[model samples]
Target: MAERSSTMKTPLNKALAQRRSKRRYSRRSCGEGTYLGYTSGRQTVLKIPTSRKKPKSRDITNQVDPDQVALLVKKEWHLSYVTPLYQFRYTMLKTYSKELSAFLVSEKQQGQTIETGQELCFKVNISVVLGLAETNQDAETIYIQILSKQVFAAKDEAQKVVWSGLLTCINGDVDYLRSLPPEFVSLPLLCTSGPESLSALVKSWLKKTFDCCFGPICITSTNLQWLAALWTGCHPTKNIQYLKLAWTIPTQPPMDVTYKVNPQDVWKLWDSARLDDGAEDSINIEEVNSFIRGLQTHFFRHFRLDLSAGSLMRVSTALGSAHHSGKIKITSPDYMTTVLQLLTECALLKMPI
Candidate 1:
């Protein structure tokens, strides 16, 4: 507005020009206070670290190594849906108390390399109650339970524990673990199953562990043969009786006790006989006794007061061939007249108790 100025640039315009020129220059070369008008044009002090970059993962397998974690399964336990055992160690971080998910990521990245059969070690808490699990003199069974439930119980424990496959483990192929003994080794299911079911495993483990924990059975088997896997930890007489009892036809139904029976074990001795189909199932004395009892009762009733010829005939037919089994021979009339004569004799005796 004032006509006295020859130069046309205003003070504001000069300041703006200086600012543009300053922006063109390297900020490092400019004086500390120089204004270039870029966002937050001044460097500020930071008390905390900011230059650290987020780490990148190096894992490619989504798997770790030290594999061999599928052999530790118990005979009685049910296993399903298993990842390899070694991966457990990679997945879990050991600690007293921490978030489960957080612990899973310890020092491990998505693509990091892990050993085969790496397992996550877990510390479990178990309080002993007598008569519940058994007297816990040392309280170590808890550790066994944890291993069984978490890592070894995984369908893959045979791979992780003793290095075995599903079929091998179930089919009695993994006997190396038996040498270790349950007490010393802390196997998952310590006292169950046969060779097919881990009974052999159970027996060997008992001998080893029981010897270590308690001591030798003061009474070792007089006959070493009695100590075999077929022995079943029972006396000879009782074993035979049990076999007989086992033979009873289960009032309910019969099942296969021979081996590889997946489930259900209730049956009378008679029922067990079906297993014998005269085949793989072992037959004992009790079952045969039951058969004899049924046969004798069904075919002949010699103690009756109302015996008749027909009844006598049946008795003779049943007993004539079977008499070899009895110490005493019965003298009854022949079939035609036996019933009538027996009635007269029974009337004379009058001993119908």
Candidate 2:
């Protein structure tokens, strides 16, 4: 019985040894360091050490110094392709006897102003809210609304605005800034809202005398007759580039809302015979076209316009038919549709590449 037991034990031990050798050979061929053994029933299996050097434990004391650590921040700028509101810097310097000191700030300083403002009310596309503007009214000083939330301003001392800077103003107001003399106002851009500003008054005065070729003009009312007047050499406002239109909506209390014309206005220009009536030379054709192109492309591209998609489809269909006939003719009772049709013709005639 003892001899038979020994014989069985010998075969079992030999089989185990053969398995271990095969594992070592396979691990070496595979280029793995070694096979860490797994559990077999209640026993734990272990791999033979390939090297005498023990694996060192991680150094718990080795750590990064707090002073040596660096913090990284990322910044972003508005893209001109995506937004029509181009970024520009306009700073204002003020001098007064009221013991107020002014500090000139960079375009970056504009952000500091907006961060400290009261409540963010209206935000169009691009806007910067400086501090607040206090206007003396009725022999009393009143804190007017956020001076320039959309317009940028420099940092001011106390709650009062000493000297201001328009880091930038977006949309239609950008056009008005072109007409202003440098460093004249609290900010570069003029107020598009409220009663006509001093700049508007000056531009209006210039328009009356026709002394200036270009002026920041405000139109209270819009009519096709005005376009005819400019075309027929009645009054030359063609040079008047920065035009702000006030749409008067009468409520319980009448209020005038200042708004830039939509891209549909470009369509209006197309329908007019003025552009084609041999009066193109008399008018600032280049300026008008340029303004139209800018409005249609950039301004329209950025802002949301409630243009009728159905109207556009119909206009496209009409244009296709006209193109095939080698003659263009579009007639529509809807004003915007008519404008669309005329624009298509103009594009074909002038902008066709």
Candidate 3:
């Protein structure tokens, strides 16, 4: 009996010693800046670009349908970041449209408190906008329009478009995009312009169908600074008309400052700050800092206050307008891709690992 008990104790002691060795090894590996199971050769951290190329100013109206472009430019879109959609196909848009329409109608019926004749009927239209993709890996932009009419309306009455949404990924990170599995389609940015309730219902439907998630993507102060610099850089090729920035100072009453700069004045400052004499096609972080400093200095000289001390809340130019609350209005199609690329980076940063 004593010999048998010793044999069992030997294996138990050996197993406990092995676990202790593994724990020590793991701690030592972590101290040496290494993960035990992961290879250092592959990058696990996502890196966002600090500098970007100046957008080329080209008319895209001829490239895409005018009506679609009009819809995108006319409305102030609320932004959201979406996760990778599983099993999403561009070929089944018609089926998706029908299904979405039915879903909306059924959802409305369940929550309806109105009389029968006053009930609202919905129609959903989904179409693929061509020529917007910047890479082969990118999926085509999907445009959805929801029209509504009274259930008992006359046949000749025209239905009104109550909601519009766009899902697109332009100039996405190739490595991160390629890392996704074949079945997952990465359209990480969503822009919707419509009622909040309708947006919530649509998001719920998408979540149920695609097995994904959506979250609001608020534009941070840093991102707004980037936009201000990027849009100002385009003044040479495209007239920005005016540059307007809104700042909120935490004073006794929370003062708001709206500083508007002349286009030519800002353009001259930007040109003076450029490292290359219009030779390089890209803008760097140093140049952006210089441009912003010039503006803040000028404002400080006039107001006797530091504009940099306040929070940047909004930025606007002829090309587009962006607010800190995730609202954007793209007024020009020439630089739309560049703007979308920046927004795509923001959305990608919000993705869950």
lDDT tens string, model 3, 230-260?
7877786778988888888777767787888
TM-scores for candidates 1 onward, in order: 0.17, 0.17, 0.81
Instruction: Give the alpha carbon lDDT tens digit for every residue of 1-353 in model 1.
Output: 11111111112111111111111222132123233121111111101111112212222122212121111222222211111111112113233113321222232234322232344442222222111111122112111212212345565444222111121111110232233333332212221111222222222333442331211111111111111111121112122122111111122343211111101111121232221222222222223333223322322233221111111110111111111111112121111011112111111111111
Q: Please report, in order, the local distance difference test score of every candidate based on alpha carbons.
A: 0.20, 0.21, 0.72
Kindly report which residue stretches of model 3 are placed more than 4 angstroms away from their true locations once superposed.
1-56, 112-119, 277-279
- RMSD of each predicted structure: 44.7, 36.2, 18.3
Ranking 2 against 3 by TM-score, winner: 3
Query: Which tens-of-lDDT digit does each residue in 72-179 have in candidate 2?
Result: 001111100001112212221111111111111221244323232442222111122321111211011011111223234334522332111112121112223344
User: Which residue ranges in model 1 land beyond 4 Å of their true spot?
Assistant: 1-116, 133-143, 147-189, 192-353
Q: What's the lDDT for residue 141 in model 3? A: 91
Q: What TM-score would you give candidate 2 relative to the actual structure?
A: 0.17
Worst 10 residues of 1 by lDDT: 42-51
